[model samples]
Target: MLYREDKKGNRISALGFGCMRLPQDDREKCGRLIDSALKSGINYFDTAFMYSGNEELVGSLLGRYDRGSYFLASKIPPALCFTKKDFERIFRIQLKRLGTDYIDYYLIHCLSDYSAWNRLCRMGIEDWIREKIESGAIRNIGFSYHGGTADFKKLIDSFDWDFAQVQYNYMDEFNQAGREGVEYAHSKGIPLIVMEPLRGGSLTGKLPQKALERLAADNQSAASLGLRWVLDKKEILCVLSGMNTEEQLSENTAIAESAAAGCLGEDEKERIEFIKSAIRESFVIGCTGCGYCQPCPNGVAIPACFEARNNFENGKNHPVFKMNPARRQYLHSTAVLGKSPMNASLCVKCGRCEKKCPQGLKIMSLLEETAEVMEPAWFMIPIKAYRMINSGKKR
Candidate 1:
């Protein structure tokens, strides 16, 4: 409901609606939720080429509303673009997908390094972006990032970008772009669009009792507290959260309207650090389970693999591999949900998923790590037996 401006003087909702995962079914209900958000003053809408049906659904739902009433944002995935024609082809297709002639915000999706940026330049993407801007097919050029801090700073300074999106949360303050990236982008007069402000729902989950007591002083949910922490930064233009329900939309909008920079006092800030410390102490793989890196060309159940490994390491009962809950769940994913009982050993070390990941994880290495623990030949028999028992329970 609250608004902030980008460097170009465009007013964006502080709580932008991330259209990455709108309900694929029940679009009428989806329309109602989006309409409710618009009525509540949310004007910034974000979608992407890689988000499956999100852009198409957003186009269909927003068609009833005037185009000028809200800002439309989407991305161009360089990995999918083999040639300049490929680059421009997708942009035209995106406009058609969204039923809009001009995208208010257009980004180079999931950029990670200078070599990649150079390749885009070599493919004539930079000029093509300009042509789109000049012709009014795209407006306010920018990028969404998943990279090292140094690379982030390089990219931000490299372009005359209108804004930039990054994976920023209190938990990842030193991980991706971190606090330094925020300051550098601001110094160059670039407004920041923060993604994963809730760390993909990790921050919204229950914290330790002592940590909860610290946040209880403010009378807010952990989710609210997490959102506010990002919204609290003045340099941020908007923080995007993918809300799936009306209740979540309302709660997020309310937080956006009220959260301001420096609103968290010293004690509250310290409390956040305490909770963050606890989260850091838990030995878990840092996958948010966003499923962005998915449908592995090789049919590897990548996200499921990571989730199982994380649960194995972090779950209280799963202190060791033999006792890990992920072992059971890992089998469930491939056996019940997957086509076969695929595990990390199936990985070919292809780096396609890494490029898509917002968290910038070393996925192939992690998959290998997962296989080392979960794919021992001696454990296969027990794991399969456990899977059969779990299946029997369902009957």
Candidate 2:
């Protein structure tokens, strides 16, 4: 695999392994994937506290490998930290979860705006990080971001970061942190690691049919088209992909092996823009379905709700709501048939999920919109009645 140097001069693989979506049911499969990644020369692995049980899984898999052979990166959730003690508490928990004493590259999970960083500073995060780094408990310090370019620039200039991670892709060239944020980071010599290069798989498996056809016409694989687009930039230190299958691993590694900076020709650029247009035609919401905003206090299945809504909007067939597969999927997955409803309509406007979302989505407002479209009173009344009756039978 190709390599790039970080600010610390660590030779990170051009393709890093994202450990967020590892299979929970298949430990053996996950193990093999990590082993294959290491053998294929991928040294950087990224995970976070918000990714449930992911740190332990990654820790267990990497435990077998010698420490020096790979670099493990994890993040501290700012939302979970209110005091300086919380930082120590989470860091200790993270080290225990990973089964390692030191994290190679550590990040402030989804630092968001410049003001959030300032909040962290008030809570004594800087001194805490300094102590950890001095004690060899943390290697390099950085942050993952999900805010506008102005805040991103302010944050980058505020601190001497060793690296930063962002959600960057061809489709998101001018979105959160956009091109300007990336260029500013590069100007300051802050090496960048990219997450969601495939826009949570939307640019590949979920691409509109027209976009897929265009990719086929150009003899391009969907995964390669998206990945190579991000890797083409010299400013990118590593591009992270959450590969589950062996085929994904192989395809991604092959792309990383040859996708040098500025590899895209004008023709390829045009094809990408065409695909973008196709996507935007039917794209209803900007959600990437990352599930970072989760476990809603009100029992809302946020990501699944958004996914159903997106699928419905993107579908070519104009099926009636009662006969729609999207509505059916939403009903079943969100537990509309169960004792308690978990659909978008059930959202309580608690605003907790918004704090956790990496995309900085106005989730409460979006949920209101989703409920209006995906869960009409005429459609949900019968289901609610059935549940009321079924609830008695179970009791």
Candidate 3:
């Protein structure tokens, strides 16, 4: 397997076994998979505090291994830290969950906005992080970002981040943090760890027949092609895949073992660009989220709403959306925030959003169209029922 040197010149494996999707229903099987991955030269293991018992699962599976032999990466959820004590409590809880004395790589999880970063700063998070690093409890500090490119750069410049993880794939070259953010972070000497390299498995199975034919002509497995495309970028330090099956794990490990740095041929590069262009053409809305259309007068999260609609249509079976039950609840609750700011239907034909949109997306018309598509009466019935049930339980 290839290795890369971090800013501190530490050698980290090119392939990190993400423990967020470890096999379940059989503890022994999980151990064997861990053993196999380690035997195959994988030394970086990643998990999070909220990955559905993943910390404990990986801890049990890999706790017996010599501590110095592997690198463990874990994160603390930023939303859970409303106070200084809360930050300490969460970090301590994470360490115990992983059965480790110190985390090799630590991160602020799901940093999606400037607000979250400000909250951390106001709560003295940097001082705390420095203490952890000084005490050797955390070897490196980073963040996993899911916000816009500008916000991402703001966070990178706001702090001396050791690394950053972003969702990247051929189809999402300009989505979320996008390629520019990756390149900017790399320029600052921050190692980039890529998540969702397969777009949560969307790029693999059930491709359009035309796309499949193009890929088949190359005699390459769709999975290998997708992984190779991401690994081709030398700026990417590690690509994390949440593998749930042994076959998937074995295939990825094999690909990682043989992967060479900057290895994409001219033909492969052209094919991937063609595939990306085709996928973009299929999108219903072309919202690049440049944030030119910001400060929505009604407080509606316009771009986010459109992005959610896009994902709902194209990524119905994507694991990240399905696994987080809270996202649906949050959407439903926020849909009733205020009269105008609440739902897409509340767009009062104000042309302000469209006027500012860099893509000239006709925001008012699309809002009405999106409401009709996603928030019909039938959809509201179940959403209302879910809210009612969940509300009573909270009470």
**Which prediction has the highest lDDT against the true structure?**
2
**Number of the candidate with higher lDDT, 2 or 3:** 2
lDDT of 2 by residue, 294-353 (tens): 889888999999989998787645445446677777888888888866889778897889
lDDT of each: 0.82, 0.90, 0.77
Cα lDDT for residue 332, candidate 1: 77
User: What are the runs in model 3 whose C-alpha is more than 4 Å off?
Assistant: 281-395
Q: Rank the candidates by lDDT, best first.
A: 2, 1, 3
Assess the local accuracy of residue 286 in candidate 2 as a C-alpha lDDT between 0 and 100: 79
Candidate 3's error at 332, in angstroms? 20
User: How close to the true structure is residue 54 of candidate 1, measured as C-alpha lDDT?
Assistant: 86
In order of appearance, the predictions have TM-scores of: 0.88, 0.94, 0.74
Question: What is the total number of backbone clashes in candidate 2?
Answer: 0
lDDT value for model 3: 0.77
lDDT of 1 by residue, 291-387 (tens): 7788787778888888777666665555555466766887777553233556787789879988878677899999998888877877765665666
Better of 1 and 2 by TM-score: 2
lDDT of 3 by residue, 1-395 (tens): 77777778877877888887677677888888898888877888899987778898898788989998988999998867888888889989888888988998898987877788998899999999999999999998899887788988888899988898887888777877888988889888898888878865657773545567888888777788788888888888888877777788889988887776788888888888766666665567766544546667766677666765665555444375543332353265446432333556657777887755534478888878877866777666666566666664210
CA lDDT, candidate 1, residue 160? 78
How does model 3 score by TM-score?
0.74
lDDT of 2: 0.90
